[model samples]
Target: MEGTKPKAGCPRAAGRVGESGMEGALVWLIYQRAPGVGRRRMAQLMRTYPDPEVAWRLGKAELAAVRGFRPDIVEALLAVRKSAEARRDAERELERARRAGLRVLCYGTRGYPERLAEIPVPPPVLYQYGPWEPDGRPVVAIVGTRRPTAYGLAVAEQLGRELAQLGAVVVSGMARGIDTEAHRGALEAGGTSVAVLGGGADVCYPQESAALYRQMRETGAILSEQPPGTAPRPENFPERNRIITGLSHGVILVEAGERSGTLITAAHAIEQDRDLFVVPGPVTSPLSRGLYKYVRDGAGLAVSAAQVLEDLGFLPSAEGPLHFTPRGLTELEQRVLGWMGSAPWWPGDLAESSGLPLPEVQACLTMLEIRSAVRRLPDGQYIRIG
Candidate 1:
């Protein structure tokens, strides 16, 4: 984040894009709802029509002439614009959002999150419900599987707590498992946590999280690109993940299965060039498999919050070195544990590396897994958890 200055016109150069400018932005929010329409097509529209307001007035035949415009989607767009209903609907929703204490961050205007502007399809208008700071404080995303093991949950909460206490804003999807725990931890530390929703910023999908939602609304911030009344659809999550990555200084994967939805966020982090860290967990647990793979593939291995803080140039100072206890570990298990680094390793490779028989190496790994000292990966790799 060093030397990363906020862009011009992002509240530093001017004021928020007024209601009139919002109309220009509203074209995107409404058009994207049409099937197969997205940021790319919207970009095309802006180029083809030059003025968003003029594009909004285009008839079906005019729209069809644009390159890459689909026949089916053109009709959908025409339907929404039929009698100017879509424009009115967007206007009314924008008014409702303002009445509900939400702020609209119009694209190409003042007050949008600066980091998001660097992404490919930054939301045209973000429905936000709290304060925004573009003063260069690091924003770290803590995400994991929705159904995590006890260890994964614990690590996520701890990471969130420590990061917030050390002066970083925690960014997350506000999903059921790890995201919820991370947000709670940030709140526990009296620090801000930004919740990016897959649905409307006004809608809290898991009704059980209502209390937490209230806390965030009062203290942190809740944002969404979806329209005011949109429901939580399955397809909404991947795009939501992109926003999470788009808004962070880095990302932490506490745990993930091979097929967990959290992988979507991880992929976005890579594509966005956000630094990634993975917390190792028990190999026998499916929740930890993807994390081990990430570490093996060159993601940073996170053993403590200080490691991340130091990498971010937060000047973290550790009090003491981490110590290991082998009181209950068999001699072979202890030796195998010693051989394993923070990086993940396979038993076959470990056997060769440690000069032990393959069967003996496998046995030691199972012992370590049972003791919660090593985690098993989906592809039979292992990593030290402590």
Candidate 2:
């Protein structure tokens, strides 16, 4: 009894601590629902008022003067604060997250991802499960199509393994296909990987990936901008992709069709000015075409793990000589080679016509042309040689 201090009752001590954290949390809630107050606009308001809690209480006239400010945003901000039902719902969500051993970090908190703060459209709040270590090595985002071929899986696995070996942490959307392969490959290689979710961090989409989601939470983290219990909506994905790229040092596209969402992530990477890498596939293969366009447009070509490392400036130079190797080729390469006609073929035309990985098809054609198995005309057309 002499060494022990008397226990304080719940109401006074707990209330003071809660009150200190509550204002910031409330401001974050207001920011999340503020319709037109995006990252830049919110920064503007925060700058003008110097306090988000005070800014949230600003009258319509005060908010209207801010750049890109809108009437609806002010209305939404005020309405959420005034609505008892909305407040109740938010409280329920918070309680549910607490029950699940999760934690929420608003944009202005010490726990918020620092890298995300640099983005133009940073999420005002981030909901996370498990530990988040931004300083933990380099985080590389690996993304691709929802329906990946076995070849894409192979490439993703190889790259992930190499990335892990290099002490890089992999990040992805936790989607099906190539995204799944990337995370799985990283974990299989005994590396860490983060999954940025389109829904609440607690809710796993493609519900079949629940096990993977659990694995990611234990070994890495599951992150989201939405509060817990938020359903998966179409709009959440595009918004979520930014965080995936924002949290990484670079992004690697494994395989993506012309209109793949992975391309959205690549666009975000470019906008964020993070390094971008693409694996080129056959023109005929829907998955590789989108990636080829990125590669041809001066994006780093993911020929091998060392190229990725070199392009990222992690390695001083590429490991070996600049030469082609046949061991990298798959069965699709042999088939595509044997079937080409004597007529000339465009890289796009040939790949689309041959049904191979665009990069693989392109690599083979380049090799064949060099070996006289084919010839490249002055017009950029390819022709079989005698």
Candidate 3:
């Protein structure tokens, strides 16, 4: 949450323009629709004319005089300003968003994401659906391949669940494979999860993710820089990666191949100076090559969600309620722990109940004891502990 404050002089820093909340948002939408006005150009225009309304009223001569405004760019702005159709489009877009119950945030306005505003070329207009708000809690992003190995899937889901349980907001692109699992885990834990889409906030790219798309809109949020009704084009994803990392305090790469698009997210994280963590997959896996390269290049090695929370300074105090979930436990250990309760039970009884060999049960109990998750009593019984 550090460094998330909105920069001074951002457009509409005094909040919404006039009495209508959508008035400032409409100006941004109009500017965004202007041809040749990309992220950088839009940023420059906003810097020169903090009030977008002022920019809208500028004549060709005045607009052309602004820094970085070429003849063509100025002409596009002027044309868009003069076209009645352009204004109608912006108005219809806002009306549609309102009917859909979506919130439109113009850059530097109240309710806009402060972290996103800190990016070099933050989107001039953002469309969001949901009620979740950034409350200074840690925001961690989990990203990886669309086609992941079983190991990768499990790791991504477990990490998501643990991070959510620890009170950190989870973020991903809501894509297939790892991203889907990550969101699922967070929702399963009754925690917030945000999806940054490459298309319009209302569109779900992969038809298979329709369920997830709805769930996120209900429990978390769906965000996009693209306007309503915009399709998710191939090129939009790379640009969308920036918003994903820009909103996070840190990013965790679960599993990515050498040429995985997930690496794009990692690059954005590095450029944004956000903490980068990589969950090491098997070196033999083709999916893991990209992750190891980042690890070698100084990214933090993330073996567990707990380690990530600790590295990002999100670990709760010892005096707080002990809800920390242990990570890195073996499958057998997890099974044994699931069967444990506050009531004391002999190791033999646990083995019979869990249908595991007594020796293996005893070994798991010893490991659990060493981890301070269980305490052994003088009566030859064990009780679960924090």
TM for every model, in the order presented, reads 0.68, 0.70, 0.74
> Candidate 1 clashing pairs?
282-375, 283-375, 283-376
Report model 3's TM-score to 2 decimal places: 0.74
- By lDDT: ranked, best first: 3, 1, 2
Models, CA RMSD each: 15.8, 17.9, 14.8
Tens digit of lDDT per residue, candidate 3, span 1-386?
A: 11244334222322233322466677777777788888888877777775655666778888888888999998888777666777788788777777666787777456777778777777777889888877555788999999999998999899899988887889999999999999989989988899999999988878798887888899899999887878999899999999999988889998888888999999889988888998887778888887887788889988887788777644342333222235577878767776774457899999998899999999999998997667899999997653
Task: Name the 10 consecutive residues with the lowest summed lDDT in model 2.
Answer: 10-19
- After the best TM-score superposition of candidate 2, give how far the Cα of residue 296 lies from its true spot, in angstroms: 2.7
lDDT of each: 0.75, 0.70, 0.79
Top-scoring candidate (TM-score): 3
lDDT of 1 by residue, 133-175 (tens): 5434568899998888788788889988887787778999899
Candidates 1 and 2, the one with greater TM-score: 2
Q: List the residue pairs that clash in candidate 3.
A: none
